[model samples]
Target chain A: MITSILRPPPIIARMAFFAVLLGAWEWASRMGMVSRFIAPPPSEVVPAIGLLYHDNELVTRFLRTFGQVFAASGIGAALGMIIGWWLHHNKNAGRAFTDWFAAIAAAPLVLLFPLFLVLFGRNASTIIAMGAVAVLPPIILKTKEGLDHVPPVLINVGRTFNLTRWQHIRLIMMPASLPTIFTGLRLGLVFALINVVGVEYLIGFGGMGLMIAELGDRFEVAGMYAAILFVVLCSACFFWFTARLETWLLQTR
Target chain B: MAVANEMISRVTLYRVSAALFLLALWEAAGASGLFFKGVLPSTWFIGKSLIRLSGDPVFWGHFSVTLFEILAGFGIGSLVGVIVGLALGMNRYSGQIFEPVIEYLAATPKVVFLPILLILFGIGVGSKISLAALSCFFPMTLSLAAGVRGMNPMFLRVGQTLNLSLMQRVRMIYLPALVPPISTGLRLGFGIATVGALLSEIKLSNKGLGHAAMQAYARFDIPTMMAILIVIFALAGLGNMLIGSIIRLPGPNTRRLTKDRT
Candidate 1:
């Protein structure tokens, strides 16, 4: 209520703005104000999307990248949750390891891909390994946060009822921490996707990222733009899904 | 014993032991040669490579080039981000209107645009610096806008009551409120800026530590690669410390926030 606007503006305004933007881009490209090789504009980019669809290459690569992101993020988030929970329970010993994790997290994990490539080879496994590592810290941090949010009173109540450790987590701690853990999941997924695409581009392998790289190398600027657009759309979809999921969970509670 | 003394000893005892244990384990494993091929370079080898690289001026040149790119990119990107963010955040209508565009841009994995940047700026330092700026711009813009929008309403009302002019209001109220988020933005932006520069360097450029590392990898120079990785880790930590100093100056007005929340 405190942040409510003076009045809701017309949604058409945004559409109009975008239209103007596209028009400007089209003009710039036509007038040779911006190079076609660099930007390609919407006029060329529009046809580029059609070409991608016609080729049927987009779907396969997208699915492959999606699978990698899902698998890697799943592994990272699960490991992070268990380790984080264990660390919180173990107290000081856990603190020592966590400090190291924190430092690792702060570094750009994408830069550590060479070692991963050596270990896992120049395939999907290397990318997956890097993605999992990159996403681990946030999940661990959020898992600990989830545990911290569980009230002492609630834990004591569980103690009175003689709940096992797993039951304590599954019932009381889970409900308390689900929101935070979900936040970690969303964050982890973002990093996983990022690392997946980065590795794909670096290794010149399957995925939209590789397609973009290939298109650029071939001097097919419009197709490259289309591939980049696909990535952006996927990212937006991720944000939308996570937001909706968060709201749904909160509402049910 | 005093609480402070006990806290220090406890933390130091645990931390130092943990570090030593890990190092000894790594050394033993490397010595044993039981790891995946040559992936696990010995700690002794890494030390030798580090010393060898330090003596070479060419190695320092690569490090300096990357550092320069980061600094320049961060400086420009943050300046532009603040201006755009402040303009958009001046009112609710603007924020709503451009919200989708901003969201889409933020979601896009900025490094994917390396190819586009390469075409636009060529294979020189230009592309890397520009890419760093582009990547750095988003975090700063988001944080700055959030900072502006989240300013205490009470302060605005007080400004109106005092009939302060636009400049006066901005200086007295907005600037103070902006400090914390701007600092956060600066830190986050710098981190991404470094990532951006190093990434592009690795992707294509013929210079920088990223290039050095990649060159080593290409030749199967494990020890040199390990040495480069250590330097990168050290630099990342050092950058954070330096940026922490920058944020300390105009810190958040937590005292005011506490009063408001209560």
Candidate 2:
């Protein structure tokens, strides 16, 4: 089976692979081949998810976490693009900023949680700060790239048409930079979600992350597993939504 | 374009001046009490505290914990990621079967698994290292798979013609091609590794800079918190530079990858 997987797999390969995997996991747990406590079957986990959905404020917490991500991405993306555009137009500042972006990006934004905690206390505000700071760099960097790569001939034509700088930007720059900006925005969205959940987990705040943390603390293994699955599903939904948005924006072109 | 090149040439000076200017502004803001409730620390205070932390053996001990977590995590993750990436990239079928899993894991914030990691590995270095490894795995796998698939077909054809051994082909053709992505992933992994370890420590552990910072925060010791942050920043910067040097060290071919700005 492994050797067959190593070769060019057929369409059935993935379904077969997943079937074997799920079956093996369930079988192994039931037969005590692996620790059942750690590796519970999907049968238990799926039901636990439903139970939690009704028992706990799972859906509410899920939406709350989603709200934080959306809010952070909105604020961070806007600020990043604005700052990025300002810096790009000012080449000196852009150069200076780019030099430091590497160092800042290298450092984890989570380390500043102490300061953020001090400022905002144990709340969603701190989570938002964490997400924004993490999301900012990539957006700024990508926005700069987007603006920089605006085709030279396009700008030259704008000049030939006697268009002002702002006019050129409004007419040409924004549309041209949209794809790259969206790429940055997408990355920022992912990072925002990650850090939001992370901060939520850390602060033991009100969210799906907090639920997961609490479940783990209580040793509700199946519930924790369920929460994690929900988190993954939430992320997948976010990806799908953003991907659709990207295509929609492209269609406008 | 030429103007852009000229600006790039002057960036080093600009960066230094900007750093100095920001530091001076921050120092002034801090010293003048413009920053409320110890929101910022003066440069002098931060510097002195940084020096003090540098001398403290306890601080070094915690620093080592973070360092160990990143190294162990990056090393283990890199091995698994590279191998999986190699297999998946080499075979379209394997890629089909596993690539979605990789992509899904990549999108899902690996940090959400912290609870499971804590349960499985306990609230010590083990969990932190696990988190770092889990976090690093995605980037490593994705980049490596892309890198492997992106390898020059001509090189493989040449190897096939010569009927070179597998290991020889790997060394002569694959390893060199793989280095750039490996370094890219590691650099990315380094950032997340630092974040992961510090985050886990902050969440639970009693050791590491995160714990120290959190403790300092609880104590309202502003200077100490700032100092630890400086150290963390420096550690991250050093790791980034180190990974960058590694990418540069594998001769001119790899160096060009870095130079080719996206």
Candidate 3:
């Protein structure tokens, strides 16, 4: 399997594939084969990215959005962990509440942004609250699954060793569940980011989403594309960070 | 026994009471005049508005547009996802080649392409459909791929040893194997596709449920906005229920079969 993966494709071939696509896009746009308004070539978009960077609007907006996502996901993860652990100890209560919550969670929570804005106002708070709400369900569901699946023998051994309830949870339950909890956190963060951007786009505030909207309103298609590319970069960075963390955790174990 | 039954009833009453209490607090907060009236319309006004809005053709028109986009996108996405998933699962070479590309695109927010699509397709049905398709595509593909990959290799070997034709093997093995994953993908796709449609409408379109919601916000029509919210939430709940029922349908012992192999 390792050898097959190594022999699958070369970096150069991948680069070539991307380059050819870009080249064709540029050629098509310049030749008026496709409307420049619709498909602004990467040539225009690439340079526009530099301008956006120098303007500092992109950085500022990105930081604001990232801050909202981090704050919301952090709060949601902590709260979900507490709730999930509590529910683990009380199965019936957990089952009853989780069923109700999951029903609510499956709904389009983004539609509640207007209500959120009314309650919290058009500030980072509203955006953060929306993100947190969006993030909570996955964390709760995953953590509950993780805790439920902990090995019975491990719990028996812990009890035999005279470990207290707190000790059993901290030493056995938490460690056993960490990997799955982390998976939930990863999903939660992604949802949080998506919700924050959507909310920001819907109700205008200064963020990357707002920047995309502003550019679209102005018909500055290139700038809009650049802002989107920045969002993509942020997402890539998120995935990379989480993957590394997952690997590190596995290695530590 | 009578006392125990009475206590159970009391507990049920308490649960209902808690919900009502929360609603009352919301109503009280809105009526307090501490906040701007437009920002926090009274619950009384929202109830009235919901009734009023339900009868309006304009609301239905917008809802239909959003619904059409979601349904169209979901149908197309699920079909494509299942096909691609099956192809990749059956072919090791193609699967290895395309896996990274799929993963990369999956992680990227397809919403980022909204502006470009709007420019290309105009702020009409085309753009909305495109956005919904793009958003719904990834999760469907991912779920289907996971499902396909998860099929027991022993099953395939057994089919091969029996000298089963490729089409027969696919019919007997792959199609049944895909049922659960494809169902799950469809469920996830529905929600994401709805969001994609709404997002596109909110961002660019002039007509749709999202546009109605945006218009309400812009005009500070709080009750109308709340009405729209209730509608969206109801539709989402309905969609989820439909999918859940489909998943729970009695089926061949596929899960047990797969479990044995694993």
CAPRI category for model 1 = medium
After superposing candidate 1, which stretches have Cα over 4 Å from the reference? A1-10, B1-8, B28-36, B161-168, B250-262
lDDT of 1 by residue, A1-253 (tens): 5444434453667777778999999999989998787788897888888898787388888999989888899889889999888777766656556777776667777888887777677888888887898779988988887887788999999999999988998889988888888888888888888888878887777687788888878888889888888788888888778778878988898
Off by over 4 Å in 2: A1-12, A164-166, B1-17, B24-36, B252-262
Q: Highest DockQ, which number?
A: 2
Docking level for model 3: acceptable
* Sort order, TM-score high to low: 1, 2, 3
lDDT of 1 at B241: 78
Report the lDDT of model 3 for residue A57. 78
TM-score of 3: 0.88
lDDT of 1 by residue, B49-131 (tens): 99999999989999999889988888989888887788677766887787567766776678888888888889999999998
Give the per-residue lDDT digits (tens) of candidate 3, residues A1-253.
9975546464544556678999999999999998777778999988988888786477788889999999999999999888787667765556446676677667777767778887888898999999999889888888888999999999899989999988988999999999999888988888898888877876778588888778877888777777887788787787778778878987898
Q: Which DockQ values do the candidates obtain, in the order shown? A: 0.56, 0.63, 0.45
Candidate 3 structure quality by residue, lDDT tens digits, B1-262: 9977876676566557768888988888777887777677777888999999989999999999989988887788777877787787787666666755776677766777787888878889989898888887887777877777888887888899999998898788777766777777877788888878887887777899989988988888889998888888778778877987977674765565453434
lDDT of 1 at B247: 64
* Alpha-carbon shift of residue A197 in model 1 (angstroms): 1.0
TM-score of 2: 0.91
lDDT of 2 by residue, A35-114 (tens): 75686887888899998889878889988998888888888988999888977898878867875675666677767878
